[model samples]
Target: MWNTRFRLIFISSSTYSALGLLPMRPCSSSDPKPGCCPPSPALKTGAWHSHCARSASPAELCRFRSLGPGTSGDTGSAAIESVQGAKNVDIIVLLPKGHCTKIQELQMTTVLRENVHVFGVEGNSDELDEPIKTVFADVAFVKKHNLMSLNSINWSRVLVQIAHHFFAYFRCAPSLDMHPLPPVEVVVPTGAAGNLAAGCIAQKMGLPIHLVVAVNSNDIIHRTVQWGDFSLSKAVKPTLASAMDIQVPYNMERIFWLLSGSDSQVIRALMEQFERTKSVSLPKELHSKLSEAVTSQSVSDEAITQTMGRCWQENQYLLCPHSAVAVSCHYQQVDRQQPSPPRCCLAPASAAKFPEAVRAARLTLDTPAEILALEHKEARCTPMRKGDDWTRMLRDTIEDLSQQWQRRFLNLPA
Candidate 1:
């Protein structure tokens, strides 16, 4: 619940050193540090949810305007187009099956320069139950290709990058008028913990990163997080925030690193602190760095849909399901004016990516222009029938792209 007088946080050159270049710090905080903790090394495994995996489920999640009472900002809606120029250059898109849409896949894959790489992460959302566990499975799958895991475990670096980017983005932002030295706090939607974990590291760098975590009713983060206590179990299912859909975020290591006080003696102390903190919830020192955590407060499938449509009506914008969950919950809270700090939300992905979720949201939108534009949007998809089958389908996608590349670039064969 820490609110900052500043609106932007930046990273000086020194911050980069802490990411890895600089040596560790001594373990000393004014407050007494917590005890140590350890976790089981064994990872659980399960099958892909293939049954109806291919079925076209709800493809969209909405950010609504609340046509009625209880809506947040969005002065007006004008069938907003769901496009944001590339947020990052070196983007690593982890595409899971049954969870991605044709537009999303293409938006991720087609819009890339040589710097961007999109890989098909062979996975099934419904079957796995927890996306976090499946991340290692995907890592294992990628290891065969000789690439190391870039999963959120690598968040230490991402946070470093984002922290530095905050300096640049905010300095260039209209709010700051290209000014210098504005105190900044960042609120990010936490998923595999990479986003939040990296965010905390950035906070250490002086970006004042805030983890405005949005969870579904499933209560994975909310239930697991604690100040003096240990983190809770792996995960729970069927929550509103699907993308925050992870249970056992692999970025726990990075979090442990951030909360451990100092790099020098932090691990040993944290390991010991974790002893009592294990099996319950993450200690407050670590979770508090996240800044704030909010559940879409019992968001339902229908509520998500309406929220999405309302976003279009009010802001001329559309948000995907996961983003919708975040926006809806966030907006609902703002309507109450909870007297907390002003929360800034980021739409991590585009709404068009999830067509079904959009369809649901569109019900509330009801405008002819919004509906027609949605129906006629240029969508591209591989149409995988199941999640497990994506691996084989990936090869076909590569071949098809290769042919397209040749035809477009070489101008040879039909």
Candidate 2:
């Protein structure tokens, strides 16, 4: 039964991107090096600034912005680094931003270390935890801003837009090599942000992409998409996937807006009802639109553990609880579809981040001895409320980084 149930298939990008969906763009760069500028002096403390990469041809630079710093990590402000040995190509990563586990952080770090230049961006909930914020700040030059309204827009969705365009522009340039895989077609993200990101990417690329949203116990988004009842759960449950324990998915509004034929009145009515009664139901037509573009599935806490354990025992692969949820959902979808199309799952965390979950799954993470050797802060955090000035600070910081990158570009030896 286990063997029959598990259908592991890699979806080819060609089915989605190359065959008249969204064409893959070539990779080219004006700068041979794949790093942003080190740091700018004109940059004021706690301000946002733009950082960009230029094309080898006389094309405009590909740019994005980042915000000010938290208390810890690089300098007194957020910092981005272009690690050496990074790859030069286009990629789509569904980063949970604030919710990533150490394993995902390491993977991202490894990506940059491979010499692939990364332009960072900020997310709202990304301000939730220290580990995510610290790693993102230290690793990549970022662009950050508040959404149209915090209540409606999802941060991960916005970052995906930034990332998609960042690579799209990069590959479109005349001077670079081509991407091996075509543009991605189906993106399986663990939560609302990932789903929202997929939607944004599809909109930009002018392709009809299938968005598969994976959920833990907090199944509001799942139910909304599946049953047409977009109602809020009364309480939030704590699961192994702690970050995904949100009962209210802010980004669902965007999906509703897109699926409802971009009707502002419909969006306003839904939002008002949701705010008042904590529930909203989609009309059949709108539900049809959502059903056609997205698939939603929920995995139980027990199933998450089993998936994690099974992967470790059968494949020697370790997955954090959140990733386990995504994989489990993927398998379920595959079971039904049997030979499903090319799909990408966003595994934004590592097993090490949730050691207890790993142990519960009967697997052990081979954590590096040096990491275990380091002193760790007491596992405590106070809820930090975002300030109004965050956007301004982020903008100034991005500008500073942009200036520094420009200086580096000018000084490079021809």
lDDT, each prediction = 0.39, 0.45
User: lDDT (0-100) at residue 18 of candidate 2?
Assistant: 10
TM-score of each: 0.50, 0.54
lDDT of 1 by residue, 1-414 (tens): 322111212111111221111111111222111111111112111001111111223441111110100000010000011111221112223455434454434434454343233444544332232332333356543343222222334333364446543543353233544344333333444445555565566556655333555555544454545343334444445433455555445455566666656563655565555545655444465556432431223355676777677655644555556656555655565455443333344444434335566665554333335334444554322333434554444434334444544465566878
Off by over 4 Å in 2: 1-187, 194-197, 200-204, 334-337, 377-414
Candidate 2 lDDT tens digits, 67-155: 22221111111122211221221221222334434433333333332222222324323233233234345433333321011111325
After the best TM-score superposition of candidate 2, give how far the Cα of residue 188 lies from its true spot, in angstroms.
2.4
Best by lDDT: 2
Q: RMSD, model 2, all Cα superposed? A: 13.8
